[model samples]
Target chain A: MMSRGEPSIRLESVNHWFGAGETRIQAIFDASLSIERGSLTILRGPSGSGKTTLLTLMGSLRKVQEGSIRLLGQELRGASQRSQEALRRRLGFIFQAHNLHESLTARQNTLMGLQVHGPGGDAARQNAAVIHILEVLGLGARIDYLPEKLSGGQKQRVAIARALVSNPEIVFADEPTAALDKDAGLHVVRMLKALGRTRGTSTVIVTHDTRIIELADRIITVEDGRLLPG
Target chain B: MTLLLHLLLRRTPIGWLQLMHNRMRLVAAVAGIAFANLLVFVQLGVVASMNSVIYLTYTPFRTDIMISAPSPQLFGGALLSRRIIYMALADPGVADATALHLGSMEWKRPGGMSKVLIVYGMAPEAGAFAGDTITDQQLAMLALPNRVLLDSEFKDVGKDGSDMAIKQLSPETPLEFEINGHAVSAVGSFKLGSGFGYDGALFMSDQTFQRLIPERTSGTLSHVLVQLKPGADPALAVRRLNERLKSEHVQVRTAAQMIADDVNYMNTEAPMGIIFGIGVFIGIFVGLVIVYQVLATDVAAHMKEYATFKAMGYPHRFLLGIVFEEALIIAFLGFMPGVLLGSGVYQVMAMATDLPLGMTPGRALTVLAGTFVACALSGSLATLRLRRAEPAELF
Candidate 1:
């Protein structure tokens, strides 16, 4: 059983590569880190610095290649695809592209986050939960609007709602506010920080946005696939 | 099963939403599938009509067993000795035997253009045939000298662009035409539609038939139709008749067996039947291609969504469910229009060719099942592209 003070994410000597043979290029090299529960951690790096790759590995979205990653009390190295899927269900992901299904309304998109949990309780209650999350994300009025009808910032906010609606133990966000203005971006980061303080939910965000850096409880930087001494 | 239902209820709506996202693409995809379905329906419809006519030729005959020469050809076998009928009757199970004389003659229209026509000659008093298509009154009219009942469905075009069968010789008009140089009036009409081999049919008495073509000997017979006594098994009676008529150069078959043999010969041996089978194959092949193209495009458009689902802890099977759901919807949706349009085409073809082209519930169900299989196959192929969507790649 995991205790309250246990780290939400733990990595040790994690290594990853892309391609094969002469074309093989290492993306991450011997990275090790631990993220405490209810803390907001931000990964800062330039493009191609392997920050996104490290986040994906930690989030259980990608296979751990040569090292161990333990998330939410499960070891990820050499884990079966089924185990990885089960682990993924306990985590949340927000991508830079804000990959919301265009055909679904904002409320429907948010409901997708809960779908992986399968049906439980009353459907009305589930809908109420989804609606409440969207309202809290400042998307209350746009709940019924499609992605095409909403602006880029609204779409990103909807993505955030989707990632957060399940009350995931940890959230892995890749440039969640890359498309948002300063105020909207800060609002998103502030929401993540407040959720950490209240719900004991850990958050790991990968971004170049310096404005939200002060809000992160811990800041980690990556350069050339190697962690920089802070 | 509960799990399956829950999975379906959960994933199918997403499938529907994705498909409905781009209305134009959905329309185009459905249209493509419907076109494929139409092709298969029409081809199978032709085969069904061909089988129907073959069976229709035998439905009017009231017999439990039929005796013919070995390997009977088109109209029937060669003339057999009447002693065979008496031999069949020798069996206590045989109630009665009727001799039918079947032949074809050139029907010379008023304009001197001739078409081949099948003729059935039986004694009007025998009343052996058992169909309401030719009423007792029509059969009684056959007793008159040189009078025959014409098939209402027979159609022919004349040099003057008039319907030779309808405009010239209708029951009300009663135009006299020459069959084998014997004058015969169209006394009444029946509903025996034409088959592939002949355009029209005429029912006349045995005496008139012998008179029209004096070549047939008085005792010669084309087929001997035998009915068993009540509670007697036809199969056992056929076996006894085959044993008794073994030396008479006659083959004994049940009525159903005879019709089945005729249908089998048409489907397997006849060139026209082979062509129809080839058409059905071509239709299925073309349908598969069209559906594959449509489904492949759909998968490509939704690649990103599939990746997102994978990242959300949904299994590959879940993604496949969505694809198959889209396929099933298209299958059923497209089948409705295909059947409707195919039925319309059947009516047009039946009118134009005078063949008994039609749609039956069984044939419709068969085509629907085929459409589902075709779409499912296309969905399976589309999954190949879906496999490329990895959540890791998405990052």
Candidate 2:
């Protein structure tokens, strides 16, 4: 069981490689970091700087090759597939290109965030929760529209709604605001910050977008596959 | 259905939604499946009609028992000697026995066009076989030399050449035709339709048949038609006749057994039957390929979304469920149109060729079950690509 005092994510001497033998390339090098609850940390890096790799390692999307990654006080190194899957449900992920299913409507895609936990009680309540979160994301009018019918920013907002509707303990965003305009981007960050303060949810965002930098509680920079001092 | 759809929508129909996302692709997939189903149905229908023709040809000769050489098909192997008929009559349970000669001969139409006719020869003393259109008077007419009875219901529309149009001859029209270089006149006509092997049939006396087919000796017979005493059980009569004929290389069968043996021969040994069976398998292969293509494309297009699902903690089983659901939907949707079109084709073919060809409920159900299994198989094969769906790749 995790205590309230434990940081949401802790990494120690984490190293990751991309390939094997002649083609092998080290993606992340001797990285160590801790992200506390209720804190919004931003990972800023140039292209191929391993910030996204670090984010994936912390989010349990990638296997730990050499060092330890403790997510919500559960060790992810050499974790079983079932255990990794269980740990994934505690976290939310937003990709760079709003990867919403083209066939699903906005509301239905948002519902997928909760539905993955497997058929919980009260579908009506789940639907209400989905709708409420979409409304908060300023997508209430487009709830029944497919991804093709929505604009770029609207699609990204739908992706965000899908990520946050489950109220996950940790949210990992990769350029979540790349497709959004200034106001929409600010609205999304503010929503994440509000969730952090109210529910003690931690957020780790990887982006080159300069607008939301000041709003982050701590900004970690990555250069040449290594993390610099905050 | 509305209730089912409502429940499905409430559960977030990811699989259904993904299939419906691309209407054109869905249509192509369904069309492919429907085409495969149509191929199977038509092939099955043709084979079934061939079987029914076998039964219809033998319907007129239905009797208490039939004695012939041990051959898989009727009139297929060696000819039986009339000695078997006398041996069968020796049974106390047997009433009498008649030697029936059967052969196929080419009829030269007026325009030098040729048509094949199945010829039957029996002793004029033997009255018309049961269920046959031939009456005692018709049998008497066959006693006259160089005289034959034609099948009035023969339809020669699709039998090779249009010049051989002797469509629906009447007894009033005593058509003159030559069979095997022997001049024979149709004194009257019978009501037997064409079967799968022959374009028409003719009935005549044994002497006239011997005259037309000179190679067949006087004692040569195709089958010995047996009649049982009214009070005798058919099984006992057959057993007794078998015992009486045990010395000879011949077998005795009831009318039902005769039909079953002929039908089984047509299904298993005949080249056409084997070809049609292979056609059914080819249709299934075509369906599998089509469904695999559609599903592989769908999986490829949505690889990233699926990886996202995996990252969201959804198990591989959930993804498999979605794909298999799509395959099931395709199977059902395609089956309806295929069946409708197949029934239409059966009707057209039945009219074009006077054969008992149509869809039975059992056949329809079998195809439906086949379609489901095929699509399910395709679903599993397509999901082999899903094993490569790594959540880490989506990053």
Candidate 3:
């Protein structure tokens, strides 16, 4: 963690669990990391290594139990759910399932990310920005199509476009290319790194896909909820 | 919540759009509305039809005033004197007045003593009051030595179902009644009741009533039913007549006043009011519950979407507006089918049962207005859950 005006992503000795008492599964155990702005970090791990859990914790989806996790310099545990969602306006998210609201078109889905956080922006400008993002992300023609209408590669690209449309300060992606073929997977990886670099966003991608290891700036491996040496 | 609405609506008018997506839920919701409305229309129409039919039957009487002695069944107060009747007619503005002699008597039947029957006496052609159906044949029978006009529904009165076919007097002209040994011709047969509505009614001349009533020689009457000239102000005439007849122990009023007095008499110390009161309360309760059930289910199904909006920072008021919009839609669409179907229900009741009934647009509107308020209030019960549910809890 060399250069930091504010660490876009930070976690300190965080722990989390599901259920209570007799039936609890500790998903994140003693995890800590700092993502500097504009750095590209890859969290590489095997199945059930708590990568998704850690990502969600940092994303403010799950409330942390024992320790503090902060995003964009704001403490996650102290903030209300609404405040956390507001912070998500500046935070992009990508999941393995590519969970797009099934009813909305790709263009509209991307616009939702922008609308959620920005209250009272000009409609015309928002439309133009969304169109611009779709075109830049190579989804210009497919923008009007629903998720089921798009190919796997195109869906992931639409997801990428949605993540970046808000111009979030940090992007957290959980295996964005896991469902794509090799060529499309490589394209997704290259896009994540390039988009982050272009916007000066801290991008942390959780991936088990080994084909695009060369595309990451630095890869950190995790096993059994503990961070392994890079 | 406006901001959240702006976000959700900005996504699509997915509220309506979503209905297009799930045709089944849409159909179910609409069906729920239809069923709920059907119940409202049917029950309310039955009640309204009865009240309106009674009103129409009596509203056409040409009487300027009516007098009756106060009683539970008596709406305008019942049984007044012949002296008061003559004095009211003597008032300068009062063009003409007549006494309506009404009382109940038992018509002896072969099997046993029959039920009590109502008897009314007034001029057959004079316009103060009229009777139900009394045909020329029935009138001849009444004029003859041994016959009286029987109820249209009472011919199979004592016979077992196997042998006796019900023969309704279904009379077209006047019939006759026998008191002691004298024959009294009935000019008409009213629908089993007076303006104070009883089971069966018989109309005859005052002379006939003298034979039927023990006090007939005393020259008293049930009360006076009156009529005014073409251009007379009824209210002014009533005041004068009341003053003129005060010495004779009487009161005077227009036909409308008489009806109001009747209604007041029925409502104020009458058991009939209890029946109407129970009916109204049950109507509100049944209507409120069904509407609330539908609205609550709709709210529950769509609550996640609302939560998503809340998560995005929409205010509570906008959400409330959205819920109320749904309620208004239900009130109108649901209520109209109910009214139409309710009319059908009332029609069946009128044709099949003895209830006095007629459905009017005014009554339909009144039910709709009441239903709108009930549904809106019930919808509020559903909306508060949406307004108060924490967005994070939904996820």
Candidate 4:
């Protein structure tokens, strides 16, 4: 059992690769780090520098290939698919593309984040939660609009609302504000930072955005799949 | 079951939303499936009607056993000796026997066009033969020379729009036709549907039959219909009759067996039967292809959303449920229009061919079940590509 004060994510000698045989290419090399509870950590790297790979591995979106990763005090190496799914339910993900289902409205898409939790509460309460989160993300007016009908920034905000509605222990984001304007981008990062402070929710973000980097409490940089000294 | 319901309530809305998102594609998919179903329904209807019509031709007789020439070809091809009837009557189990004379002759219609028709000849007392179809009064009229009963449901117009042989002549209307140079007048009408064998039919007394075709020998008969005594086993009588008439070269069959034989021939031995079966196969094949294409394209368009779901910890079964839900919806929606269209086609076919073609509840249910299975199969096939959607690949 892990206490609430423990680190949300701990990594030791994590390594990852793509392809096989002669075509094999290493994406992450001997990476080790710990992300504290209620803290915002930013991973900074250029294109193809393996920052996204490290985030996915920590998020349980990809299998740990040659190292140990302990997320929420559960070892991910050699974990069953069912266990991984259970672990994933305690976490949230936000992508650069704002990958919302095009046919679903903003409110419906946000509700998806809570679906994996099962039908625990009444329908009204669930709906209210989704509405509250969307309103906080500056998308209360566009809650009924589809992804195609909303502006790029609005879609990103809806995505952010979806990630936070679950109140996950940790949020793994990859360039979440890439499509947003500077103001909207900063607003999203600030909201995430505030959640970390008030709700004790930890966040790990992969991005080249300097503005977002400045807001992070901890900054880790990667170069050519290798982690550098902070 | 409760668990299933919960999962369905959670997952099906996404599937429904995805399908309804593109109205044009959804309409196109439903239309394609409906057309395929229509093809299958129409073909199966014709095949079923073919079987029923053959039984209709014989249902009126009410005989327990039928005797005909060896390997008799459907009406009027072979002639049996009259002695076969006498031999069958010798059996203690047999109660009555009647000989029927059947022939096909060219008749000169009122318009002076010649058309081939089936002519049946029996004793006037044989009026009791077709209890419901022919009345005792109609049988007494057949005793009069040159009087005949015409089939009322025969097709009068041919595919070329020219009158083949008969017109829509009624019983009260003065009707005269020349069969083998002998003049016969229509006195009444009966209902017996047409099939692949013949279009129109005429019933007359044996005296008129002999007069119309003088070449038919007096000692020969077309068939012998036998009725068994109460409590007599038809199978036993057939066996004894077959033994007694071994030298006569006649075949013995029960009424039910004879009907089944005719239907079997039309279904298996006839070209039309095979064509209808092939048509059904092609319809199923086309349905499968159309559904597969629709589902595969839907999966392809939504691959990114699927990966996102997987990343959110949804199992593969949940993703599959979405595809299956879409398939089931398409199946039920498409089948309704298909049945309506098929009923219209059946009406047109019955009008043109004068055959008893229509939809039955049994057939309707069968087609609906087939549509469900076809769509389910398509959904299963489409899920093969869904396996490639991985959260790792998406990012």
Chain A accuracy as TM-score for every candidate: 0.96, 0.98, 0.90, 0.96
Query: What are the runs in model 3 whose C-alpha is more than 4 Å off?
Result: A1-4, A22-25, A117-121, A135-161, A217-222, B1-11, B54-395
Query: iRMS for model 4?
Result: 1.7
Candidate 2: Cα lDDT at A85: 90
* Full candidate order by lDDT, most accurate first: 2, 4, 1, 3
lDDT of each: 0.82, 0.85, 0.63, 0.83
Tens-digit lDDT string for candidate 1 (B271-321): 888988888888778777777787788888878888988898888988888
- Across B305-344, the per-residue lDDT of candidate 4 in tens digits comes to 9999888888788889889888987898789999999999
**How well does candidate 2 score on lDDT at residue B192?**
65
Worst ten in a row by lDDT for model 4 chain A: A115-124
Of 1 and 4, the candidate ahead on DockQ is 1
Model 2 C-alpha lDDT per residue in residues A1-230, reported as the tens digit of each score: 67879999988998899999999999899989899998999999899899888888898888899999999999999999888898899899998888888888998889899988887458889889999989988888999999999999999999999999898999999999999999999999998999999999999999999999989999999998898985
Query: Model 3, B1-395: lDDT tens per residue?
Result: 32454465553443444343455655555555555555555555544543443454353234667655543233334456667766666777666777666566766545664545566555444543543244334344344333344444433244432233224233333333444445554332334422223444455555556666766554666667777778888888878776766665555556776566555554444565546555666666766776677667766766755654453344565567656655665666667666777677777866665555556777777777877787789778878678544543432
Could you give the C-alpha RMSD of every candidate to the true structure, in order shown?
3.8, 4.0, 8.2, 3.9
Clash-forming residue pairs, model 1? none
Classified by CAPRI criteria, candidate 2 counts as medium
**TM-score of each model, in listed order:** 0.90, 0.87, 0.64, 0.90
lDDT of 4 by residue, A13-121 (tens): 9989999999999999999999999899999888889988888899888899998999998999999999898888888889888899998999889988887676555
- Candidate maximizing DockQ: 2
